[model samples]
Target: MIIDEQWIYCPVCSNKTRIKVRYNAELKNFPLFCPKCKQENLIDAKGFQIIVIKEPDAKTQSR
Candidate 1:
């Protein structure tokens, strides 16, 4: 049996994250948390390619 492993990278910091992906893994609308950046980013990943999901900021209630 062969095992394929890949490291997920933080788009913001461009660093390897603690998350790892296998060969038969797929992710969509996933929230990736990076320790180095200390932030969460939405992303879609497949194979070794990752695309960052851009989310709009919520509107704040006016006082």
Candidate 2:
């Protein structure tokens, strides 16, 4: 059986991160730290698709 693997890229700087995921791997609200950009972001990954979770601005949010 052959397993497929893919590299995860940073959504902020669009650089390759140090994370690797398998073809069948799944993640929700995962905290990913990018060494290239040095930014921490939350991501949801399934299969080979990665979606970055955006945070709302404090000033724009209703108090």
- Against the unseen true structure, what C-alpha lDDT does each candidate score? 0.88, 0.92
Clashing pairs in 1: none
* Residue 34, model 2: Cα distance from true site in angstroms: 0.7
- Measured against the true structure, the TM-scores of the candidates, in listed sequence, are 0.79, 0.85
Residue range 19-55, candidate 1, lDDT tens digits? 9998778999999999997999999988767899987
Write one digit per residue (lDDT tens) for candidate 2, span 2-54: 75998998988989999999889999999999998789999999988999999
Off by over 4 Å in 2: 1-3
Error of 1 at 14 (Å): 1.0
